[model samples]
Target: MSSWFEERRADKVADAEEQRRTRAFEAELRREERRKDRDEERADKAQARRDKALRKQARAARREKTLTPGNVYRKGTLLLVAMSALAAIPAQVAYFVKKSLMLLPVPFALEGAAWVMAAGVAYADERKLPAWVRWLLRAFCLSAAGFAARINYIHGSEQGALVGWGLAAVTMLGPLYFEVRQWVITLSAAISNPRQQAEERARRKHDRRRRRHHRDVAKVADRLVSAAPYGTLKPEEAWARAWAIVHGTTEPGMTPRMHAWAVKSAAALATAQQPLPLDSKTIRTRIEGRLHASAFVLPTASGTPLGMTKSAQVVTDLPPASKTREKTPVKPARRQPPAHRRSKGDALPFHPIAKTVAADTARKVTAVNGHH
Candidate 1:
């Protein structure tokens, strides 16, 4: 009985183990099925997206082909564009000018027109289109709508004619929004206020000349500073002086403009200070010897005109007043007429003795003339 009972227990244990194994295997199979379903779903989604994109591209291509010249698409698109613009322009103008909402169709009409124009341009061979049509197409595109919206926002922020801009925005849509804006404003200003336009042009020209002069001065300063010995003047000093001389301005200090100027000057000075070849001395010597034969001896070293070391000390030690005096021409003082000489109308304002002397000299001159 005991042995039978033990055998039953062993069989029961084996059955429990088999059942657990079966459950685990089924669970694994279910997991694999779930994973496969997920993978299939993802693949289907991706394929659907690709298919949608391909369909969209195909539709665009077909639309473009239809929009080609001599096709019905061209005529339809142009008509739609013209009708939309005609309707939208008036409505927008009225709404903006009068603040009337009765022209609610304005935005919608313009948007539709822009979309149509963009699509037509995308599809058509622009070369076959008339210049005005091409211009219209480019001026009314998807990007133009965004640009117009931006302009409206800008006008609203500036507290300017928001309504005017809002109405103008309808026609202002263009891929070349900035360029169109610039040219249109320029043209309008040229027509409306020519004096202002001329002034603006002159100002721009002056600015350009000033900038050119500044750059030229900076370059010359770089050369001057490089050739000048390091101790003679700081690069900044040289640059400042150069700027003042060139621009005829007494403004001092290293300004934002001088930052780059100084950097270039330093670079030039570095290059100038670079060591020369050993043969340079021999070459210089030979040149000097030849010059000596012509009674013109060259200095062994490049030095200042005063034969002094180039330093701030040298400049400070020298008398600038003396130098100026040497350069300035002196006029000889005019000799005063002799007190004894006198003309018929002449008399000394002061000194009675001078008056007597003049009278005596006059009598003597008369006696000489009589003798002659």
Candidate 2:
């Protein structure tokens, strides 16, 4: 019986220890799951923060790009014009409503006419219509506005002095504001920058001067421009071609005849300035003549005359005439005829000095050969 009790107690202790280990394992698994959930939540929060920062940066960049001075002015002016129109309509409606139900259309028509004409002015600017058309639209807009203002003034005057002025002011302000905006848009479109305006002015002035100076060429250019297909030929190109045709030269301010005259004059001046060529024989003859002339003395008060000097008389240390003999002149070797003689058309032209230099070189070669 004692052995039986001891075995039962051992079994009970093993079961309790197993149950405790199982419970501890379950608790560890739950802690791991909670840790995983906390990590996922942190990651989500980080991603959300990054996305929000990116959106904020994008919004700022968009605003920076969109907000410009011109955009602000244009959009603000339109808003103001809209506000003016809204404010002025109530006054007109109130005045016209008391007169007659049929006359309710009159106030709308008056206000509508002014706004329509104002819009017409903007349309004219967009279509690049004539200045007079824009001015006409402006006039119509002002006329309608003026008529509306008169009606408003008359109607409000029956109420009070301050009310009359206030109604008239609001009635006129819409059209006037829109007209000024249209003017601004037109001027901005026509002249974007002061520098561009000045450049356009200068270009026009230069074109006028050129046309005045070259009337004939200008007429020909104009004719050519008129004859060509529209937008096919530029005025400058036409002018260039016409100048070439009229002057017979591609270069402006010069003609073929003028160029020929200039060349001829230059050649003549060069020839006039050039020294004459001297042959070897002429050079020797001139030297000998100078020596002979120096030997003679002119008759002075204390000296003998040149004609009375004798050949035999030893005037100084000069050698006797009998001992001196004239040097035999060496003739240059004759150049062989070329197999094919070049004609004037085939020959290349050279400077005039080249021929004189060739002759001198031949004479020198001959003289050297004779001495050798």
Candidate 3:
């Protein structure tokens, strides 16, 4: 029984040890999880900081791009124009409303007309309308502004001279400023770089000179342009075609005759530059004469000249003379006169003078041949 009790005690001790180990393992696992969570939090914080920095940098870049000089000028001008309109419109409305409520729309109508005309000027420029149209819009805009100014002057005159002048000036200022701004914009658009201007001038001068020099070709080109479908043929292409038709050559600045002359001149130049060939017979004769003048010398064992042998004499001894035969002179054969060819009209009766003339000519030809 005591031994059995000891065994139960031993089992209890082992169970306690197992519980302790399980608790330690759970604590270690919790510690590991907390470490991982902390690391993840640090990484998230670092990412957030990087994103914030990037956002700030992007914002600065955008600000720098948006604050350019041209953008400032354009926005500032628009702001000033808006303020001017606000200031001017109220004065006109006050002046007109004092007269009658029924006349309330008059102020707006006058302001609208001036602004509409101003807008029309811009539209005209955009559409590339004629200068006259743009100028007409400018005139209308100014006229409306002047009429409004006069009304303001009349209304303010009841108060005082200074007030009247101030009101009139203010009333005119908006449209006048707008018109000046438009003029400035137009002139700025029209202005070109000095070099570009010079190039344009030179091009115009060249075009004028070309038209003057090729007046006939230019006329034909103009006719072609008129005859073709609208926008179908370019001026340059028409001019090229016209040049070809007039000069009978596709090459610019050259005619067929000029080409022929150039070819002939080139051929003449090539011929002049060529070296003349030496005559073979003349060279042979010169060589033979030189050989005949010099004698072939032979030396003995002591290097002294044994004797001189004439090459001409050696040449004569090299070949034997052949036999010759005499010939008898043969008599020359007599020439026969050519036969007369009958004309197609031989069957027809001829005039006496014509027959006699023909007969005389035949006899003369035969006599000449016989004498030869």
Candidate 4:
């Protein structure tokens, strides 16, 4: 009986173990399904984010393409800050003249036109056109209406209206001349700066001279200095030899015993070379100057003076022409009478303001002849 009971207990234990394994397996499968669903969700989100970013970038690019210089994009960009405070007086005069329109029928008509145009724009405010276009159109229409109203007012009143309107126009627009002058000055400064122009001119001159120098120097001497035949030599010796050949001078390896190195060293000691910077702005500015100087016009077969070709081989043979001298005639010196041996003719008496200049001259001549 004990053996049978033990067998039953083992079977029960086996059955419980089987049920636990089944539950664990189902849980694992359910967890895998949840993970798979999560991964799919993440992928979908990433795709959606990419699509959104692409759309935004496209919109920004489209906006940029619509920008134009003559439009409102450039209108308020003008800097007139320097014309402040001091210009307020004129602004006040403008305001006063604008206000005084009530005193004159012609001025009143212009003011009425302004109000009508403003009302027109106000009524159309709900229209969804671009803000810049609206502002530009309104400015144009308003200016036109004001002009027409002014003309019509003058036509109606005849001779008297003509005089009063002309006077009023001058008074009203008089301050605008200063405003125009300020605009002119601002535009001039914004367009080109004098300091920048001067610097550019200087840079162009330097580049032209430097380019020619480089072109000349690019053709090194037929033979570089060699220390093989001679003793140990410095780099200066090499430069000296090259310089002599280029300059068409016999000074190379000549007396005063200038080691090619010493001459080069002395020169290096005397002059200073500024370092070329890596910044792009500086480089661009320098390039602009060089282009402006290009008009100075170098004589070259190649479009660019720096270009090298077969003709460069015979470059030494074609030395640059030296400036010519013209023989100028020498003028002879004029002989002058001695101050001690004064002639009555040479000395004229001073006269008072009351004496007519012509009479004074005649008297002086008579006095001189009498004394002689």
Please give the RMSD to the true structure for each candidate, in Å: 31.3, 17.7, 23.2, 39.3
Q: Candidate 1's error at 66, in angstroms?
A: 2.8
Clashing pairs in 4: 236-260, 236-261, 237-260, 237-261
**Over the stretch 220-312, how does candidate 4's per-residue lDDT look in tens digits?**
532343423554554455556566666655564343345576898888877756455545455446554654444322234545443233342
Task: List residue ranges in candidate 3 displaced over 4 A.
Answer: 1-21, 97-102, 127-131, 154-166, 179-213, 231-236, 256-261, 264-268, 275-372
Candidate 1 regions exceeding 4 Å error are: 72-372
* lDDT of candidate 1 over 1-372, digit per residue (tens): 999999999999999999999999999999999999999999999999999999999999999888775355335545544553553355444445465566556556555656666656544432355657756676666554554454344435455676546534544433233334334444454469778778999998975675475686768677888898878977667777787776666574445567679899999999999986434344546444643344312122235333223231212223344433455677885995454544554431323443554465556556545743
Compared with the true structure, what per-residue lDDT tens digits does model 2 show for residues 261-321? 9999999999999986555666656544654555434443336443424442222322235
In terms of TM-score, which candidate is stronger, 2 or 3? 3
State the TM-score for model 3.
0.57
lDDT of 4: 0.51
Model 1 residue 82 lDDT score: 57
Q: What value does the lDDT take at residue 305 in candidate 4?
A: 48
Please, what's the RMSD in Å of model 3?
Answer: 23.2
Give lDDT: candidate 4, residue 261: 64
- Top candidate when judged by lDDT against the true structure: 2
**TM-score for candidate 2:** 0.56
Q: List the candidates' TM-scores in order.
A: 0.21, 0.56, 0.57, 0.24
- The weakest ten consecutive residues by lDDT in model 3 span 311-320
Better of 1 and 3 by lDDT: 3
For candidate 1, the TM-score is: 0.21
